[model samples]
Target chain A: MNAPATERFVVPIGPQHPALKEPGHFEFTVEGETVVDATVRLGYAHRGIEKGAEGRNWTQTLYLIERICGICSHIHSTAYAVGVEQLAEVEVPARAQAIREIICELERVHSHLLWLGVAAHDAGFDTLFMYTWRDRETVMDILETMSGNRVHYSANVLGGVKFDLTDESAVAILKGVEFLEERTHHYRKVVSEDAFFLQRTRGVGTMTHAEALALGVVGPTARASGVARDVRLDAPYVAYADFPARIQLLTAGDLEARFLARLDELLDSFRLIRVLVAGLPAGELTAKRMPRKLKPGEVISRVEAPRGELFYYIRSTGGEQPDRVKVRTPTLCNMGSVITQTIGHNLADVPMILVGIDPCFSCNDRAVTVRRAGDDNGRAWAWADLRRYGIDYYRRIRN
Target chain B: MDTITTQSPPRWRTMLDRLRNWSLANSPWLVHYNSGSCNGCDIEILATLTPRYDLERLGVKLQGSPRHADVLVCTGPVTRQSADRLRRIYDQMPEPKFVVAVGACSISGGAFRGCYNILGGVDEVIPVDVYVPGCAPRPEAIIHGVAVLLKKLQPDRAEEIDRLLVEAGAVVGEEEGIDEPNAELLGAR
Candidate 1:
């Protein structure tokens, strides 16, 4: 057997690692501190959601799809509903459209705050994590009050939103957003100039503007890298067509830039949310009596989920249930960039770089592994087996 | 590791045993493993630990490794590839091991009921003592469910595993009326 002399070993991070909240396996080959190569293996958390959607009826599938990712449940259900509505060719009320957009922006606020907290935790800044999470409760409280549930606020139905925002509800929501707005300004200041935080984020990891465009990354990941592309701005749908938003971008293409982009998006979301709430149209909560069965059609529903662009391709057979429901979540598109960007960074920055994508593992689980020609071992490395092998290998090396 | 020959055991041994069981119940270190979930439950589970829900106030800590965990807080259905690792994880934990299966999918395959790749709920792969059902249950619901399981653990665990199982079944009608058998009481993960 031939082997490299340097301690350039492949360190596998997860299927279940401490850094990653969701299950994802990444095998990184490192020479000392610098990462030489990286390969990500997802599907540690694949629940066959798309296949599950095929069996259930149009109505049942909406609830099922909403459960895809807890953080972005509204976006998933909204995208799916918009697709179904288009397939059915049902006219959604302006009120419903604005309501969906309202939740979408509110969700963005919660999600960005969620990302900030999680990213802070990744960098060993527990205090920052706690503060952001505590303030995030205000948004969660508003969401729960509006839709009756916290995480999976099932606000959207097929043709329109399930819940309507009353003047009182609107008042409560604006108060929450105002509180968040003031807090967001403080966070923006901290991330931009904090000495300790800047050491971990600034110039630590670089993804050039061209690399971002070449990899075809979406959401803040691409926006941070100077690609001025946002689905909301480019292809506005639902209420976005009615109430457009400012696209936030940063050209640094670094971790600090990623943080600032999300914060800027949050600020933008708060402003849009205020607009949607104030200018909320007066109409029926749902569209007029929607037909039970659709008139056979295909619709591609694209919505900006908190992470990035959530693309849902839905095909209907004119039956009750959909023929096929293919979801291409934003995390999947942004994931490739993480693999490419990690190559030149140090091992310690891996968590920061990975979290920069704000990955949702269950969304990106459809994967196939192809074995290399020379690799022959059929041993499945259970944690028990892996732990034992590690001990034995170390023992032999020492002797 | 000696069971006392005398009917009445020594005071020091009993005290130490009491301390161990109390500590175990008070600070239930959990290792959350998502066999195959949509991450609705995983994030909710994580939220349960954050400041708002403050799972730490209940003395709960989310452990990274199974061996260090007292309770296995599992989410989602048992996928074929993950079943082996799920079982392996359950095996790794030292006994009097409690498995709290969280989410509807983990409970009875929820929405992904007949999916080919899914092997149904977590119980199909490993024995689950407490079942918390929700499409993605609120963090508060999860806390209540874990409390139900921890309530059964004795001050000094006596009469081995079988008796522990009997106690788990017996205490369902207490504060949180919902138990493993009554699926009706369960909410979405």
Candidate 2:
């Protein structure tokens, strides 16, 4: 019996492709329209954020980490602050914790809304994109009213929040919630019944629960596949420990399921925000005993962003500045399953599959380049070239 | 052959139409590029797009492609490895482009200055039209800065170009105190 011959062709997704908003390279090996394999090569937007954090004080580091991902800014700051607080053993006020939770949930609303719009845009559903984003403003306005800014709210401080919400802000939040509820329901209908969206998303990028668990997929990506793992529920931190998190799960592991799961989570976040707001504890917004200096210690903290689990590890050397800071974003885990799921899918469905993970390239890659001579060429290299280079390097090591 | 006496629109109408066209042309589609920063400006930029600020209502669209974008909203200081890629993206956009530097780090490297691999602000590599000042400028301020830049795009503002140049630190005559050594290095490059 003769073995069948394998044919390979390369397809490049982007550094500036229409499907992606960020800069990164993804090369797919294809036989016909089916992707045989995929490889992601990032470092396009590396900005040395970790290295830069080394010299900044604990106060400055909070602001720095918040800039890791625009959509996940609150989680980044929350995780960093929690880690630093653990190192210093500083007890945050109850009111501060509740406020943080409220802000975190509000951040989730904005992020999911943004993702909803982007997902719609990816599939050429421009109207849905417009509608979703138009509603997204209400959430941003709510956040801006609470915090001075919309994106990097700068709400989180070393010990607590920099500002407190007034009674009027609470009323504004209630009004926003009423608007969000109606808009979210409309979005839910579109996600479910919109014929074009269903055709584009349904049965595309299907991931089995086992595959997701095996691949270490996290957040909605994993939850949509029936693996009920949520950091907020599992390892409760901040105010989440006090407030019960009802994890939403879906058995269908298709794009629709993932979309539904995110929408459901967004609605749940609205409920969580309202709960925190109604039960607004009266106390200091900051820890009165927060020390100016951080003691020598290392700590790790994890929080659930809209995307998934966000991990932060920090080491303080009894100095004003941190010795080291490491961030492992949810996208890092979610990106792994992309190659696995994208195999056997059409080229047109590629963008939808990629956006399903809501991958944040900036959070994953932040190194500065020291250009080597050979890397400066204009000639494009495919995944085959990368594979060949890897094999050659392995062979040299073996020899 | 009979002579045709038809003429173009009256001067006032022409001027009004030109004004409308100028505003339309200056209503840029923004494409955000995060070269790497903590994320402070990223959220603020997103906030500008959200309903309270509603950048789209102002005719600003957040595009996914550099080719379709009129303005590049660059956040964070450029990292060493991302420099070439950033240049590639900038080159991909069409002409008559504007780059808005968001956040203190993107304008003057903020607190991330003197790092081993940071290029210290995006303007070192790209020509920036406006600089929004803040550790991360408020979304309202970002909208204001972009509005000012759009206003500067009007043909009648040609006389104001010199003042704009000076504000952007692009004027050749000024020898004002150089803030960061990185700016000098960027100039040399």
Candidate 3:
């Protein structure tokens, strides 16, 4: 549908579009070259993960949760393990905590580099995309050598970590980190100094501090906008308490700032890895004992995922299986800002803006659809009405 | 109409068919779609294109549209919502196209086996020509899978490639069990 004179046209990208690495649907209403309005529809990658978690036992459920997002699989399982361990009242060894922190930081290096390549590809900077990804292989090799798997390392067990670092693997990791550090210096220079790349990023999709705070953005996206919110610094779960992460902040709040925020975070990650490795705690890899059944309790675990804040809520009814499990990934927090910022921009810049948030469809596709009773034509439901309807519906099911 | 039905095909028609097959076998373009993956396999598939794996050295390129692609590379199990869209993409591809189902989830719903919304595997929604196994397979494994598909595209060299794979310990058939019981259809072959 289009207006007669104004001629507003909607361009739908998704389900199988090429610019996106995952499946998502976005409708951008444009007037000539400028985008007027934008709306997003998710759930293309929804596999009923939350509902599936309810059916499996605690340990089996951990494996399923690790599949939630392959890019951030380590952080997903870390959040879950932290929460589950809290509910079980089991104390993991200090060495295990240190190893977990090291892997988390390594995963961040890989994830951020992966995002840099994908964002560069979206901006038509294929050379940067190829070079970044090529260098990303170094971190991937280190992960594979440590955990035996590249993408889903399964590094974290419920009580502790599965693999331990020896002097040899430690040396390998240091070597890889050193090489990556050099590359990071070059990439940071390119992101800030290269005039053509800056044109695509600088001052584009600028989200101010107030707008970032209002939208509830998280991670590097918010950090770029000058929001000082990081779960690792705030909560300090696992070994983060000992080896703290330095927060990278910028106030420009533009695409370039987001790139710089992640790059600067990489430098911090390299330093953190060095400190964690040098001061490797000497202890057992796992706890002495972890009960098969967890105690009846609810716990919330928050961790700084490579993207932003990753939250896991666990409620166990003193059984082998959890009663309810909920996850809120960083992409969900940053998605709103994308829609708000896309307006008043050119259609060609929409992909770059979307990639700016490094959106993950599979990680944030937990949703449900509801319609008003006896309504023939579908209409949007207000929040209050929807909440009332949910209460009544669940009550009816209980009865 | 009677003359067209009764006459044999022209020589140019046969030559053109051979030419099309040669090009399709030489440079097999791929279009990747995520039905409901966890993003593990999708990233690995992208990694194959990078310099480390260098899948393009095999003359394989990832296309942005299905119409221009010769192979449909799918990841993850088929979710109910994405089933229709997956089918539409497959329908849009040109004829003689093949589907490569990457990741254990897409091959048999892997970890998400009994999820309510999952339809179980890429083969449930579309025919899969090759299945690459792993929670997320390594990029080298993905390249091997592509080499296998390329061998299948050229039947004349299938035996030579099968011998090479066997010598390299990547046995082509009967070892890595898949649901598709056709013994000859297994492995990159």
Candidate 4:
């Protein structure tokens, strides 16, 4: 794969790289064990979502935007719904808003647990991965019980929510939340106390508090670095104003700190869910008569997604369809930190550092042709030469 | 060992079909690729592998390489950039390989249709064996779609399917000696 043992070489990790579940290519140039430079090629998952929204009407676009991420579908829809609701000047019923908040918190629990499982698996801790994913069923079940769909719950409509929390559903949710709270504590202890797990995470991929702010990282990644800028706490939209969210802060600023921050939030969600269910308001599930066409205006809607802050830039041209809808997902914003963090790291740690941002390449990819890497600086070989090289290498290894 | 009964007829040849069907149905190694989905169907596919749905118990292993996989499980609509890649992956899989297109978007470009960059569903790029329909289908729907594909793989079961399709005028073939798979049998244009 390389020439001289002493010479620096470029290793291209794919649009189909084995390490990545989603399609994203990364080029890493290494000088022996240390990585000297890195560049990422996206757009493998770009389905022209923002462009598609322009053709869809306001009501239909609600379902379209929600599919941006299966893991964070609720937050995306909530962001879009609230923005559209505001543009229409329709005030949502209090009960409907509370239902939306509870679902959002449940989504947080699901997303964090999902991220934890994948992160642990990336670190070669399959045991933790299996355990966390197994426990995630509790939340998935609760969500299914509530909304009749697991992944894209479609809980948020234009003006309000789709369903209410019945007494029976509330009781079931309380039990599920209680079970998850205990399991989350166990996972937190495992990540912190397990010596081998600690070895991989404790000081690995440490980002300075200032660097995190400079890079404009958000959500648990930012909170882990001691920056508390949660959209729910800061703006308190919808039910958040009635039920304020407590910011989960950590200052370790390492991979472990990121883990701890999300875990703390998972526990906080449990508390929030209980509060939401116990004090369930009485009103209609959806607001009456939301206007089909929004008033001519442009507004920015922000929501604290499970991953981070989801920003929706919506422009209504006094028509049924939006003039333009721009979605700036947190993964796209946090990608800067991931690329920058890859430098000065060991080649083995590249995957670990890159996934620390918990990237959803599908959410971030907007079609752009990545420049072919320029550092292949070796002699070009013909097809015959490459075949010969493969034959000789395998032959030598066999001998 | 159980004794073979000679009274009814020779029954050993039937085990050949049964054994093959059992092995094929039991262990379907899946190679998942997101052509251009929102990650909604992708995560649900992964969830199918997790304990809640446990697609593994049915012998579904998520493989990393297309060369090693028995089925190519794809999610989302096919974007222009990914259409070529999707075709290449489909070509790379071994013979008898199946393609399971999950999500409503992948089936007929449900949401992402008419987007300039999107080529629409997986079928636009490659032949799909099964279509699991949902904005993003649940894990149960995914498993059921796979089961439908696996069921058709059996030689005896395939004849039954072909007969049904022939009766419905979906596939233009007779039940006897019709080995070739017609395009219409793929379902849902």
Q: What DockQ do you compute for every candidate structure? A: 0.47, 0.31, 0.79, 0.51
Candidate 3 Cα outliers beyond 4 Å, as residue runs? A1-5, A368-399, B1-16, B158-189
DockQ of 1: 0.47
In terms of DockQ, the best-performing candidate is 3
Best by lDDT: 3
Single out the weakest 10-residue window by summed lDDT for candidate 2 chain A. A1-10
Residues B1-189 of candidate 3 have per-residue lDDT tens digits of 121122466888666666777798778999999999999999999988988767776678997999999899999999987999999999999877888999999999999989877999999988887888888988766766876787766778676655554444344454763235433344652
Candidate order by DockQ, decreasing, is: 3, 4, 1, 2
Instruction: Give per-residue CA lDDT, model 1, range A1-399, as digits (tens).
Output: 445546787898877667887777788988777899988766667766787888989999998888778788888998899889888878999999999899989989998999999999999998888899889989988998999888788898877888889777898998999999999999999999899999999996778999988988899999999999888989898889889989998899999999999999999999999889888889988887777888888989888887888999999888988888998888989999888888988899999999999998877776333479888856555647644765685467434
lDDT of 1 at A18: 75
Any idea what lDDT model 4 has? 0.81
Point out where model 4 deviates above 4 Å. Answer: A1-6, A367-399, B1-26, B155-189
lDDT of 4 by residue, A1-399 (tens): 555656877888867655787888788888887888887767778777887899889989988888788788899899999988888989899999999999999999999999999898888898888888888988888998988988889898888888778777888899999999999999999989999988888887888899999999988899999998899988888799998889999999988999899999999999999998888789988888999887899999999988798898899989999988888889987888987887888888878777788888877886322346885556645647744865685467434
User: Candidate 2 on A12-91: residue-level lDDT in tens?
Assistant: 87766657767677888877777887887776566656877887777887877777776788889999999998899989
lDDT pick, better of 2 and 4: 4
Query: What C-alpha lDDT does candidate 2 achieve relative to the native structure?
Result: 0.78
Task: Look at candidate 1 and give me any clashing residue pairs.
Answer: B133-B187, B134-B187, B134-B188, B134-B189, B135-B188, B135-B189, B136-B189, B137-B189
lDDT of each: 0.82, 0.78, 0.89, 0.81
| Per-residue lDDT value at A71 in model 1 | 80
In model 2, what is the error at residue A262, expressed in angstroms?
Answer: 0.8
Writing each residue's lDDT as its tens digit, candidate 1 over B1-189 gives 122123577898777666666778778899989888877788778777777677676568997888898888889888866888789888988755788899888998887788756899999988887888777787767876766665566423333322432343423444565455553353222
